[model samples]
Target: MNDPDFPRRIRDAGGRVTAARVAVLRCLAATEEPLTPDEVLERLAQTAGPVPDRVTIYRAIEWLAAHGLVRQLATVGRAARYEAVEDRETHAHFQCRGCGQTRCLPAPPPPLPPLPIGYVAERVELVIHGLCAACRAGERR
Candidate 1:
């Protein structure tokens, strides 16, 4: 999805407007589920012609993640996946153990128990794993 305000968003975050960055962000924004670097490259390649090189894609992913523009998810037996966080913050994801498909789920900040002194939390990743609707239906039949 080509978000019209992407350029401005990048600028507001002190990043220069560049083709690779824009393309990568658009790729991330286009999908509901997070994408791995290889998947991102594929998406970009299918769009026009040669996508950014592997190194460029890596850099773009790192940059976007560092800038809080995307969220990174590392599930078991899968390369890290990235999802655009342009809209909301602090949500959960549902991962299907049966089909390995992941979906975003909205959530308010979860209540937490008191923590020990001198410890702070940075990022929260919540994944609910089970059979998705289709997978569950397949099991039923």
Candidate 2:
């Protein structure tokens, strides 16, 4: 919807707020799990008002990621996923191998291991892959 906080977040990140950007951010924030660009487009399409094109959605996601408003996740699949980077703590993710559904886990990110000389660590992302409850149940059936 029309939360003023979305635009405010965009402006605070030093980027000009646009409809596509606000819509994309809002969609991500509304969901507990991360979503691919295609998923974002689908959700936006289901909502009221005009929906941005694929290119516009991609550009908006790129801009949001560059400005730290969204975080591009490291995924196993070809399509990259993104999640809103709000005040949430650094946590791990659980990706269902069967359904490809990714959700945030409550565990904290592990500490970085020692690196070689002149090497710098940016961030750590841990994803545990397994069959979710539904998938596992289906396997038993």
Candidate 3:
């Protein structure tokens, strides 16, 4: 999502684009998989200036998610991962149980078959979990 105009788009959506927000957005944009808040902070620290605290980062992530700039992945543990949404590409993720690795699967999301009559669909999320190739190979040993 190398849209140079992303900051402007965010501002147009009634959100402020701060340095911290931009850093976090950039970190997500550079990755293919969702990243937890801690991973985001570490990535931000490496690229951006000083790293923001956990609470601050979490708050920023929540705000960004609310504004549709990012989407949070459902987690089975303490930390939740997030990814940017501006790339116009939609796909599901597969979490490997054996290795704890999260991989982005290229399969298309299920069709939302139209509502009966007056109902409307807003958002949908589908996630699949299993052992990835590496994890399965390791298990065979």
Candidate 4:
């Protein structure tokens, strides 16, 4: 994704797209998998000059998340992973117990259960945990 386009999107979302913001967005777009803030910092360091501190990354993530541009996934005993929010389908994640790898899997459409009389549901995420293919193979061995 182009930096100009990314900054434009951030501006459209009422955000100021600084170099840090563009770097973070570019890093997220480059990956097929979601990444934690530390992973994001590492990738940014390699390509985007000196990496922004974790505090800056956290602030950027908060801004992006608040503007509905990023989605966060909480893993067990680890930092949350984040991805750009271009799609909103119900999905499940396969987490490797051994290596802590997380793979996203498409899930069935959510059932429309009745909400309480005065309640509304905005969003939902269902995550499933298990061994990935490599971990499973290793277990078999």
Write down the TM-score of every candidate: 0.79, 0.89, 0.82, 0.82
Best by lDDT: 2
Quantify how close model 4 is to the true structure by its C-alpha RMSD in Å: 2.4
lDDT of model 2 at position 40:
98
Q: Which stretches of candidate 2 lie over 4 Å from their true place?
A: 114-118
- Per the 3 Å backbone cut-off, how many clashing residue pairs does candidate 4 have? 0
Which residue pairs come into collision in candidate 3?
none
Please rank every candidate by lDDT, starting with the best: 2, 1, 3, 4
Off by over 4 Å in 1: 1-4, 136-141
Instruction: Provide C-alpha RMSD values for all models, in order.
Output: 2.6, 1.7, 2.7, 2.4
lDDT of each: 0.81, 0.91, 0.78, 0.77
Instruction: Score candidate 1 by TM-score against the native.
Output: 0.79
Summarize candidate 1's per-residue lDDT along 1-141 as a digit string, tens digits: 556787777777789877777788888888878888889998888886557898999888888888888778856557788898766676778888887787778666567777799989875677877899999999999
Model 4 per-residue lDDT tens digits across residues 92-136? 676677778777676675577898899989866666677788888
Task: Rank candidates, TM-score, best first.
Answer: 2, 4, 3, 1
Q: For model 3, how does the per-residue alpha-carbon lDDT over 1-141 read when each residue is reduced to its tens digit?
A: 446666776687698887667677778878888898888888777763577787888888888888888988764665788998866767878887776667677878878777889887776677788889987898899
Q: Of the pair 2 and 3, which is ahead by TM-score?
A: 2
Best by TM-score: 2
- What is the Cα-based lDDT of residue 93 in candidate 4? 71
